[model samples]
Target: MHSKFKFFLFALTLYFPFTVWSHTPSDSISTEQDITPVLINAYFSQQPILGLTSSAQTINTRFLEAQQTTTLLPAVNTVAGVRMEERSPGSYRLAMRGSLIRSPFGIRNAKIYIDDLPLTDAGGNTYLNLLDPAGIHAIHIIKGPDGSLYGANSGGVINIQPEGFDVSQNQTSLLLSGGSFGLFQEQLSIQRKVDNNYNFSVDQSFTRSDGYRDNTKLHKKTLQTAHRWQYTPKNDLRFFALYSNLGYRTPGGLTRDQMEENPRMSRPAAGPNPSAKAQQAGIYNKTFYGGITHRAQLHPKLSHTVSIFGSNTDFENPFITNYEYRKENNLGLRTYFSYENIDHPQVKWQMQLGFEGQKGWYKIDNYDNEQGVSTDPQAKDNLDNIQHSFFYRAMINLYTRWTIEGSIGLNQSKIAYNHRFPEITNASGRINFGGIWMPRIATSYRVHKRLALRGSVSKGYSPPTIAEVRPSNQTINSELKAETGTNYEIGGRIETANRRLIVDLSMYHYQMDNGIVQQRNDRAEDYYRNAGEIKQQGIETSVWTYVLVPNRQRFIQALNVHSSASYNHYRFGNYEVAEQDFSGNKVTAVPDWVWTNTVLMSFPKQFGLNLSHNFTSAMPLNDENSVFSEKFHLLQAKGTWMWSLKNKRQLQIFAGIDNLLNERYSLGNDINAFGNRFFNPAPTRNYYGGMKIVL
Candidate 1:
């Protein structure tokens, strides 16, 4: 660790030799300021940071475009108290101020949105990997539980906005990239505006790679289109459509001994069975989604927005034990109305009412796989899920400095399952999860122009997802229950008068009941069960500083430093299984400390360099807390140069390197595994280079 620190310090010293002795007039700052005004899309309204009472972060796409646009983990990791992990090339899981206990492969316990349309299905699953990074313009993350407005989520909220058409001119771009481990990617995008009222954009991307580990190959293709029309001054319409086909191999986990011996090996074969590699174990998914949103201004103080969305997914998985196929369909509608009295001089208030409804249907079939070929059908099942939620929010500002907001949401959900195998012994079941009410109250006080204080208390509730109740293990869990929790938080933000440094700090405590945890059986199959109460308390902080030396002789145009850290104290309360007292154990996968620091240097002529470092403490691997995963330190760097051509044409060349130290670590690990097989080794030192041409 000391050597690593010294290496980093030496790198910094080489770049900034006279940084400490440099001085510039405070008023002669660069035209491009780092700390600019920020506005947050708070459900129904746009609120400035000074008026916000909750913790939120926004990431601009420029940051993503500067590096490899292959995955979102790097860009999202800049945020405090957030973790995004890619187990393999195309498999990802994320958590925000929570454990990855319930997320085995995909996004769970979080609500995701693309503009005003919901991306999470009724079964509480989000296919975030379906969209390419190049198509996204911005991302907004609301940390902590926000069920009062988002509905039926215990973790957080994420809103993704896609690229929009440029009104000035028609544009086309092509990007090509290749890297180590046979990584290659191609992307094309077109943007055009027909007139003052209509605009459209289309993007397509393809990525393929032979991963660092055996049976970890990946292939993905995505196409997305977005259009907007302003029929009249008071009415507008927007549409989004997407299609994606993805296939990735899963190199199952390995025991510690196996990992140490050969980290690149795939899972070994069981008795009288083929290995994962020989069986071609992997996942194949094809999905299509479309949504339309309409906005109308009814009156001066009233407005309405409505959206309709639908999706279809065909999924197939070839595991060592069996081959599973699923056909899933989902449809949903979201509508909201807002009324505000902003004309008032002394007192201003706003009220919003909204409702969301969704339904999902799934047809699943399992078949025996004999050396990568399906032999005979083993089981068949049909599942249906429905969810409805209504929410109301009211916000008021007193004296233009004190802001208070309150919200309530009522949610209802139900599930039905039909077992179609064993003709004579067919069985069916239905469960209704009644109504759950979630409420929240938040307040913020603007102490001064450069300082603010905020506090919030909210309740979170999440029902069991379809996969949790009926997992791939071919077992139906009829006794699984919902998880509920309460969160209390207080935070503040401060900025220097010169607008060069900004800091944000927050502390939160959450207590949850009926928390769900995943466990593996003797056959390496996954299942879920309630793990009793748990408590999580933590502090999150972020700091940003910008330094500029305006002299023309200096090579550095601007230097920006952004850092974030989190400290967590998570523990289990009343957790016990099979008469064993597992109380007071540390929560699995919840690291004690996580920190990230990024340094960006801007030079002349659109040339820039970025260096980033991340550190994560050791974390428990299971409920027993007897075993733990090793801590890891990662270093990454990227450089980009842009050139301008005649007739509004441009070209950009970029290169990046990851895992500079080539540390041996597991990027993603199976949390609780049978026979203590949990390690999934990540790639060692790798490099990528790419170029983009615009016409």
Candidate 2:
């Protein structure tokens, strides 16, 4: 493995070699001075990554739109090492610093995006309920691997940007919601700027939720429309069209004594009691996505951007003893070019060169006759597969504080089955390189101006996917190869110059070689091989800030505290699971200890108050299992009010309570919080309310 990844980078350059450094974020305001907004939403001097840095207690989208919660895994489980693993109610799954939270798939190692693209499915599943935060304006999380854009099995990356229309014409909004399982939601929006160079917006959303269990269920529909045109002063043309139709119902998995006796039970029980009935292990799916981007400026350092994104996925199931129907079709194309120069004084340049390609054509069908019939078979799409990839990148600007970035890529993929599953036709290729150095003398000044006793050392990479190479009604051997990973991060972050006492931290030591695990085959007990030599190391910390300064509540002006927290540690070297004895052990649904805490108090406006909490420590139910669940916590709260009836326009009313101490957790499928738990129950203390309008 390349002389053990170059002797593990020669033992982290003999232990942190003064933690590297190099700059370009305009010397980052002369070395950090209390800057918040979650490091301006995870670094953005117009997008591009390398040795990236972010902290101000991370978690900012106005602190996740202050509890407008519908996704983002429950406002990022309220920070502090994060946690959210529900499999019902607007679908959920995401866990980092602890690695794929013990895998039940979906939310695959973190990789979700709306603007920066990527919405994974086919291998790296991502289900944040297909995203819909009513045109969210910002949210950027690079998290792991210093976030060099994306590639491979992305360890973590969730960038979303919406809400644009500069000129700001009459601006409009409307929202209505109904509560308690059988819940309903609606949102409508409009923003304009015609002529003055042009800008536009049109939005839509529909939501539904029911049953705390039984077969937990939900429904969603969303559409986004955008347009921006400016031709003249440097040319610009941007247009985006998005459509999302999500259908749900997949409540299955549990056995650790039925998730500890009943974390809201469900099986065929008509999935989440909507009058209970069905439950033959039902499954439903529908998805569609679209994209477009173009920006141009021939002069001034040269500029260019071109994009094309596409998705078409469909799945419908009645059960599955082998298969009934499952489909996937995807297409992606991207092109880019940018170069901004600073004629050398301290040397300034922000360069980007790009090209990306993705294609997936999936299938599954076998009710051709009978086995576990549902009596309605007349479908044929025997299945066909195809995969592809292409990439190129760069970053450089040495001297004046120093900075360097690198990229060399080639990922060719192929899978064929023109007819008789041609032994599952397969073809592959791999090549990757990563680099980052911000070493212009590791900073010794500005430890107080908002903190920066400075330090850095970064390098990250990921590659390997195609449903991990032929998996779904399995049988292997088509020459599999490609599962490369490498990451080494030394971190530091803390800021508060009027951004409220903030603190952010990082500590990593990762190493991976020929790592593509899932080896065990008593003649097919879970196949998809490329095994051995897998060792994992971890430690990630986060603590958010903003204790008070929110508008005062109506008549009781006194109660304000907004907080966030985190802590995680994990390990496993030789590896082993399900046949127990954990070999080197320490990996069985991840949780050596994880944490989450959120507290917000308000009452000076008539409505506006919140208190939330989350924590995870003992986890390990199967794979010989450590079996020590029963140490989960969750509590929630919210309130809001504002009004001005008649002609003028304005009205708001809100209320909340979710798991308000109804503490019951289930991540992956640990079989705990219920009778045997494998997920279900993360909603016991439930209460909701809403009302809104402004014109």
Best by TM-score: 1
As a TM-score, model 2 comes out at: 0.30
Give the per-residue lDDT digits (tens) of candidate 1, residues 506-548. 9999999999999988767789999999898999998777766
List candidate 2 segments past 4 Å from native.
Answer: 1-85, 88-91, 95-99, 102-153, 156-180, 191-193, 202-232, 235-255, 258-301, 304-581, 584-678, 681-695
Every model's TM-score: 0.95, 0.30
Clashes of 2: 46
- Model 1 earns a TM-score of 0.95
lDDT for position 488 in model 2: 54
- Regions of model 1 farther than 4 Å from truth: 1-34, 165-169, 424-426, 549-553
Residue lDDT tens for model 2, 1-695 = 25565355334323321100111111111123233343334322543122243222234434454564465565766544445665676656676554443243355556566664566643445655666776666566655543344544435566666665343555677778777777788888786777788887787888878657766567778888777788778877666666677766656655555556775665422232221124244445666776767677887887877767777767655432333465777777666677778887666656565655566676655352132345543333333333333444454554533345444444344444332333333322221222222111112123354554334333333333444444433443355554444555555555566655555556555554444444333211234444333455555555444433333332433232334444434444554444544445454456665544454444533344545455567766533454655666554556656565676566777767666555566655532122333444455556777776767
